[model samples]
Target: MLPHYAAPIWLKGGGHLQTIYPKVLALPSVCYRRELLSDSTQETVVAYDFIDAPQTHAPVVVLFHGLEGSSHSHYALTLMHMVKQKQWHGVVVHYRGCGGVVNQSHKAYHSGDSLECEWMLQQLRQRYPEQKLYVMGVSLGGNMLAKYLGEAQNLALADAAAVISAPLDLPMASVALEKGLSKKLYAPYFLRSLLPKATQERHQGKHPHLHWDHLLASNGLKDFDQHYTAPVHGFDNADSYYRLSSAKPVLRHIQIPTLIINAQNDPFLPPEALPTAAEVSACVTLYQPDHGGHVGFVSGPFPGNLQWLPQTVLTFFSEHA
Candidate 1:
């Protein structure tokens, strides 16, 4: 049986689905700042900060977005605004090739690419060794962070981690994303944003595995991964990547006070993909909300709408950290 509060969130008025609210929703605008990090690869990750007071050795929260999402995404900006009261520094890590610059390596970020998050943590830690470092990853970002936390498991670098609306089982998520009216509505948007970047990589003469036209022809998440994600990222195929990268197997290994938040109504996740509190690490807390859509947890009926995810996230981080 589903949890008592587990219910799908549908269009509030029972009409057409709307992506954006009528007003700005009483959230502060996110300020964008760019930083250049050099390794073997020269990458520029954009950071979105909400700085109201001086922060010395203060806890910093890093925000990661879903596929095709960036620092400008509504939820990303909303999260930055929500953390201002805690006086926590909010920084959104823009994935390679999404923040207006191509990455030095031909490899693009995949579902289990925790190295990037680790690198970001190392970068932040180098600057503030005494401060706490927390991460909140949404959707694809969530999957990556979960894998990272599981692998890191009590490492001093990551103080706490939270994942909102992650598809723990990538194979199941791939199957879910290929069905129903929702698939038709969501698939094109992701493909449109994803394929062009792959094409650009091909133009740069770096990624031999990327077939620009083939990626453009992909129908869904699975299709895209099969054609683009796996090949370009060193996987045999989509199935291999999904099987190896799923976070479920690693959940038990996570030692930090991690929180996994998923909404039953989340279209991207199959009902079976949801994890139980018992199945995860003792330190991991699972919050499967009654409704939130896929990271869309708006509340109240007003011109100025309010979101529940950001507030809930801050509460989780504060309580754990």
Candidate 2:
């Protein structure tokens, strides 16, 4: 078993954490207030909202999931429970296809898709204009959230935000996933979740252009992105997507107080993928630890609860809020 100090403040992927917390994951969790918002293309976007009991004017904590994840994901549910316990509301933003309900438009979710975050925050501001809004994104979701903050640094949609295990350097992250034993373990898990949804969309005639053979033949996430995500999204190639979509460039532009956690031992992000303390803006805090096994931070002995990240998040938000 990994020691307690080995567990860092952040982890990159939302994949294996579910396997580690299967028992505690079965606990009765609070349900969120779900809604479907429409974009300019008239697509129905799914969002789950969990309002606090007794309605305190606390910050609305938005949780963004990694590839093919929903609010029901163990981490999302666990964080939602934490938010409720702290007297704050929680909202999980489900990317277009991830909500189990297909969106009306063809634009699916991507690592750099920050438009949805912008739109969701706008909607939240309209309803609860007085309440503070913040977001905590995991893995790819973290990349998206960071990009959004950097892109909209001057905007008032969010007061502050936190990104747990974000891959600021996507190219490095891709390389990490491709190395030796890591490839055998990580690639298949992502493909299993990503491919079927594309296949489903193809069957539904929403994305008839997607080719199953091409998708199946693809070896890694970068390969899949090169063939599918880039072409559909108007990028030159996977490299361009990795460069432009990466959050590193925008990290310096973020005006809001943001915390980014990177684990040195994360299977997804290499040690080099971690941002240097100098790279962070005055408002950004980069927390790096010796280990965390890609979001697996088991604390205590009896329950071995995963409370560190959530509690740190609450404390950070409270201090800056």
Candidate 3:
């Protein structure tokens, strides 16, 4: 059963503030043990930061981060803290080039990069065969997790999974993010971090043929993904990437228990884009709260914490673990 989420009095109406508030507020710091996994391409490495539970037999939660996010992300740290509190192991998988280090290969991660996720899951399963394992992903990571779950079915890498604020329909989400105040506010913030990484990759001779200046001047994600992400990753364009990567088409194939939480007021995904009961498999649970903008589910009074999301995730994982 889905829990009712009422936004705090101060953050009830505005999506932008709800989305941005928790990110700016301070949270507890988490310590991690970094492990580098060699990419199958052999040109770059993916970094995973592990936060081990005190007990060896505790269940493990594998975390996949959103675009440009790492173990340092607010949600990631908070969840790590929660996992520690429960004496469960947690590992945060840093997408290619997202571990505060530029990847050696020209190819970076995308919303549909299930292969990398599969590799990480395989590693964890092998390393801890006896321990129960669960997976949780946010935003782009959530989309990739859903794609992996649907495609892999019974052979899915984790026992159960949870996805939050995923842009399940990539094209629609992209368009939504590029429109209105979302474009004016959110796009620029993402691009600020993205452009520099693209530039760094270019300087490393990753995509020598492309015009670096033109790529640097990209105003939004669609433009950037078209010029760099698509070409380097072998997609024809952003549209092709979105078409192939979107998780919405494959939801029916998921054979394992999965939880999907989408805030109706998310700035990046319109309510119409969310899936209906007929759209998902029997094993999937779709929880749509009236509020909780984007990844934000801040409750309580002023200076609220993100304990809501972490608690909800842990409870779901506990039931299925």
Q: Give the TM-score comparing model 1 with the true structure, all chains together.
A: 0.88
TM-score of each: 0.88, 0.89, 0.97
Runs in model 2 deviating more than 4 A are 1-28, 206-212
| Global lDDT of model 1 | 0.73
Tens-digit lDDT track for model 2 on 259-285?
A: 887767777888876888677689998
How many residue pairs clash in each candidate at the backbone level? 0, 1, 0
Give the winner by TM-score.
Answer: 3
Task: Name the lDDT value of residue 47 in candidate 2.
Answer: 53
- Kindly give the stretch of ten consecutive residues in candidate 2 with the minimal lDDT sum: 1-10
TM-score of 2: 0.89
Name model 1 segments beyond 4 Å from true.
Answer: 1-27, 39-53, 209-212
Ten residues in a row with the worst lDDT in model 1?
A: 1-10
Candidates sorted by TM-score, best first = 3, 2, 1
lDDT (10s digit) by residue, model 3, range 104-163: 876788999888788879888988899989899999999999999999989998988999
For candidate 2, the per-residue lDDT at 192 reads 87
Candidate 1, residue 72: how far the Cα is off, in Å = 1.6
Best by lDDT: 3
For candidate 3, the per-residue lDDT at 73 reads 90
